[model samples]
Target: MASDVRFSDSRVGVSTPLDSLREVLGVPDLDTALLTHALTHRSYAYENGNIPNNERLEFLGDSVLGVVVTAALFRTHPDLPEGQLAKLRAAVVSAKALAEVAIELQLGQHLLLGRGEETTGGRRKASILSDTVEAIIGAIYLQFGIERASEVVHRVFDPFIARAAEMGAGLDWKTSLQEIAADHGLGVPRYVLEGTGPDHDKTFTAEVHLGGERLVVVGAGAL
Candidate 1:
């Protein structure tokens, strides 16, 4: 889809309209009006009096995204300390991360921007895209249920989780492994560890599953 639009007309033809988002979201019958509202920026709403913008929806979606990511992180990394889990959550929910997801979905193309915003390149702005993505999530949650919203959240964020793991970003190898699993649309990696011999002279073996291909890693440590 085309990423840039001209501001010559007040209403630019979005190359990837709300209907095109259906395939990306995996929701075939999304409500057009709700999605349209999600795409409307405050500037645009002000210009077109009586039309609502996505601020409220963005507020709700921010909460919805938090719950979904928090739950997934909690469930997936049972062995991870609270600090690590929180860090991972923060990374995934960061505006930069959401903006990347919006870019991947070509959501910028679908945004409804005011003439000034359009001329100023608001379509390519990270904040606008991220907020719009959140608004869309809110719209989905209001129309569907938490279950569907969660699914969309995970689906959109899986690849990002993988990238996070690859970067390490202060996370341990085991945490990275679990994130990798989640990235591949798989359940969290399950780790099995065993120790043998005396505490002072013990050998430990650890095994874990990672990735959609279900790659397994085994390692041994002795003290």
Candidate 2:
């Protein structure tokens, strides 16, 4: 599979190569055109003469992802209530979680972006990365069918689902912390957030306070 062929975005005169991406996705036989479309962000499409974007595919993929995740959760955690199951699904399918998966797959490098988006660090944006993941799923489903798409979804998301199940209420740290604090008669947990740097690239610092005493301060850079 010589996957290194260039698909040109004519308006921007940009060429996106999919060889590395195909290997990373573990879907070598995916149709090049479909895969290219999956990687095409709206910014890129708009800049390149308003060509089709990945939004439709993202929509389709969202449904596919939901079904697979829901079915798996239903089957595996037969004892869980509906509320817990919904929470588990939300945790796994959230933008943050999907973005983490995209980062692991190095999907950022494969995104097709416009000049503005590329310069503004759109590749690392959680929203774009997550949508792209879904678009890829849509492409896989269209090309290969539901069974193969489910395999890919499981490969990327099963660990997240399992961790969410294990964590249960802990998946929502703020709520979990508040509950623990309430039980311990510590009043309520207060969170103070501070953001720094440019809007396109920012670093966030969070402080957790209990009983008017600051307990933890942690900083994380935005992706």
Candidate 3:
């Protein structure tokens, strides 16, 4: 909402690395400066003499995400109760959910983190990744207003919302699996996660076990 904000390259151009990211986000005209601000972590700012960071944008984006997701759930599920809607919203907007979306966008590679954070594996941290997603959303809102922001939000988040809806009263996939196991008297489901490859391009394999038997194994590429 602040019109006076400025960045070295205020207008994003084809020469910038962010041009590809802008294309992925379907917001080709987004200000490069704003996008850079959104990607800047506090540690990066602190290391650089307290320059601006993404915290403010993250805050604005969190609210925008909540509002957009809530409206979508309300309109899309007119027959659902308030409690169910709340659960669906929670599932779609959770930190883990947002982090998954961030991973899909390959956002970590583009983040601006301090050297210390980089050494400590900050890129894979769910909090930072999720916060960055919010910051980007905030940047979009600031640049284009809620209408355009809503369009982007829907594009990225609608599938997750629909998936959550299909989970019925179980909310997320984990909870749905748990409920199903409980109903079948299969005991609790246990998850084992293993990561392979280098820090920058690790692949994760998750195995779900029930009653001491491995039920499924799923793999995901680097975040």
Best by TM-score: 3
- Give stretches of model 3 more than 4 Å off: 1-4, 7-14, 171-223
lDDT of 3 by residue, 39-81 (tens): 9999999999988899999999999999999998898899876
lDDT of 1 by residue, 1-223 (tens): 7411111221234343456687889875666667788899999999998477899889999999999987887776688767577778888888888999999999988999999999999999999999999998998898788999999999998766655434336547666556666666778787778999998999999877544535487889995
Question: How accurate locally is residue 112 in candidate 3, as Cα lDDT from 0 to 100?
Answer: 98
lDDT of all predictions, in order shown?
Answer: 0.80, 0.83, 0.87
- Candidate 2 C-alpha lDDT tens digits along 1-223: 6532234334244334776676667776677778889999989999989888888889989999999999998998898768678878888898998999999999999899999999999999999999999999988998788999998999888888788775466567677677667878889887778898999988888788897585755656676
Arrange candidates by TM-score, descending.
3, 2, 1
Judging by lDDT against the true structure, name the best candidate: 3
Q: Which pairs in model 2 have colliding backbones?
A: none
lDDT, candidate 3, residue 183?
72
How do the predictions measure up, each by TM-score? 0.67, 0.70, 0.73
RMSD of each: 13.6, 9.7, 9.2
Please give the TM-score that candidate 3 achieves against the real structure. 0.73
Candidate 3 or 2, higher TM-score: 3
